[model samples]
Target: MEHPARTLTARLLASRSLPRTDPQVRRALVDEAFRAELEARLAAVGLQLIDNPYAEHVAVALADDVHEPVFGAGREYAASNIGLTRDQIALLVIIWALIVLPKRERQVNRQKLIDDGQHDMFGQEAPLPHGEEVAGSLSEASLLADFAPVLGHKTYVQGKLLSRLAQLGFIERRGGLIFEGPLLDVLLDYRLLADRIIHGTLGEVLAQAGHPLPDSDGADEGL
Candidate 1:
C-alpha cells in the first residue's frame, strides 16, 4: 500500500500551497507521527514544511541548513531565491505589513475571546482564525498614493510590480483592492518581518499615512 505521507507530500509539492482545512493538510497538522514522517520525507530533499498557525495556507521551503549549499554556489545569496528586484521586495514588504500585521492582531484577539468563552477546562480548543475571516483588503489607489514615491512612482508600481506580485501568489487584485494571496503569509516569517515593520522606519511612514501599526505588548509572541 502506498503510504499516506508520500501522497500528502506529493500533493503539497504539486499545489505549492494548500489551506489548513484541506483533509490531508488537517491530518498532517494533528497527527504527530504522520507529520514527522512527512517532515522526514521533505528533509531528504533539503526542504522543510512551512506551517504557521496564524496563516491560512501551508507550504514548503528550502531548509535553512541547506540554504548555503543551494543558493550560494555561483552568486552572492540575495534576499530572495526568486528573481525579485530590490524594489519589488520593498513593495512586497510594504503590502505585507499593511495587511498581515493587523490581521494577526485580530486573529489573536478572536482566539482569546474563544478561549474565554469556553467554560470546560478540557474543551477542545477552537481553530485559529482563517485569513479571509480576519484579513482586510487594501485599496490599490490608497496604496499608490501613499507609497508611489518610494516604490518607483504610481505608474511603475501599478504597471509592473503589483502584477508580478499577483502572479507570484503574494497578492490578489480585484475591484481596486488587494487581498492577501496564498503565499503572502506562508513564505514570509511573520515574527521577523512584523518586528522590523512595526518598530522600523516603515512604521513611521504608515503612521503618517493614517495606518499605524496596532498597539500590542507581547501579544504578538503569544501567537
Candidate 2:
C-alpha cells in the first residue's frame, strides 16, 4: 500500500512539474479528496497544509499544537531550535558541568580562597580571576572523563564526537581549552529544550556521571 505521505508528496511534486494551464492537472490540484488527504497526512506530523489562493504555491506549517509546545509549555524545544544528537547532548551536559556550573561556583569561592590565602608556589592567589578565562574551557583529560559514560572510553569515538560538535558550532578548541561556541548561546535560549535533551534523552549517562538533573528554570543561564 502507498503511504499517504508518499502519495501526497508525489502529487505535489507532479503538480510542480506541470503548467497550470493543463486542464487535468488543474482539476487534480483543486480536488477536494486530494486536498483532504494531503492535509490529513501533514496533520499526522503536527503540520498544516494550506492552499494560497493569491499565489501558485502551498504553504505547509506547524500545527497549533506544535506551536503550543514551543510558546506555551516549553517541553518541545529541540524540534524547533538547535538540532542535537544523543552524543551532542551528552557533550553539552559535560560542558555545562565543566564550564557553566563551575563558573558560578568559582565566583562564590573566589572570596573564600582569597580570605584563606590560597596561593601557588609563584605566590599568585587568584586563579585566572576571570570567569571565562578560568571555567569557559576544558582539557582533553577532563573531557575524556566527562564523556566516558556516553561515548565510552574509546579515544576515536571521543575525537569524532568532539569534531562533530565543533563542526556543528557547539564547541571550539584552542590550545588546551575547549570553549563553548555561539550555537551554545542559541541552545541556552531554549533552556527547557536543552534540559529535556540532557535529562530525557541522556538520563542513564547523566546518572553515571554523577550529574544532577537541571531544574527547568535558569538551567541554561550561563551557557
Candidate 3:
C-alpha cells in the first residue's frame, strides 16, 4: 500500500479538496509530524496547505510568493484564474456571507461551549463539529427573493452563476436548497473577510436584506 502521507498529498493534488472526515485528512488534522511532512512536500512546489480548525475541508493553494508570477505574468492581475465575471464574483461573495458567516459563528460558539466545560460527561473530549453539524444549508427560493435585486440577472444567478460555483466546489445545489461545497470555507480566509463583510459596504447590503451580521468584536480572538 502507498504511504499514508504520500497518499494524502496525491489526493489533495487530484481532488483539490478533501473532507476532514477522510482517514488521511483526519490524520493530517491531528498528527503534527505527518502534517508538517505533508506541508513541506507541498511547499516544495510553491503550494501551501489551507486548513482551518473551524472548516470541514482541507485544500492547497499557491504560496504567496508564487501568486504574482503565476497569475500576473502579462495582463493585469485577475481576481480568479477561472474567469469569473465581476457580478459573478459579487454573487459568490453574497452566497458565502449568507452561508459561511453564520456557520462560523455557530462553530465559534460551540468551541466556546466546549472551552467553558459545558460538554456532557460522556462527550467531554468530543471533537469540534464538522460538515452539516457546523454548517447550514440555504434555501434557493429565499436567496432569489432576497438577493435578486442586488445581484440582478435573476436567470443567470439562478442558472449559470450557480452552476459555475457548484462546478468549482464552492456550493452544492439540490432540490431548491444550497449547501456549502468542499472549498467554500477552505478557499476563503474567514479571519480576513469576515471583519470586512461585517463592517464594510457589504455589511450594509446584508443589513438591507434583514440579515445583519454581528459585530466582529463579538467573536473570539483569531476568529
Candidate topping lDDT: 1
Give each model a TM-score. 0.92, 0.39, 0.91
The parts of candidate 3 lying over 4 Å away from their true place are: 121-124, 218-223
Provide the overall lDDT of each model, using Cα atoms, as 2-decimal numbers: 0.86, 0.53, 0.83
In TM-score terms, candidate 2 sits at 0.39
lDDT of 1 by residue, 38-141 (tens): 99999999989999888889999889899889887666556678888788898999999889888888887777767777534533366777756798899999
Off by over 4 Å in 2: 1-83, 104-135, 189-223
Better of 1 and 2 by TM-score: 1
Per-candidate alpha-carbon RMSD to the true structure = 2.1, 18.3, 2.0
1-223 in candidate 2: lDDT tens per residue? Answer: 8664456555544432222334533554568786566667668777665432211234344677787665566555544344556666666666754455444444445544554667444434433243243345667666676666556655754576777777765567888668755344333324344456445655546566665544444433333
- Cα error, residue 184 of model 1, in Å, equals 0.9
Positional deviation of residue 20's Cα in model 3 after best superposition, in angstroms: 0.8
- For model 1, what is the C-alpha lDDT against the true structure? 0.86
Candidate number that wins on lDDT, 2 or 3: 3
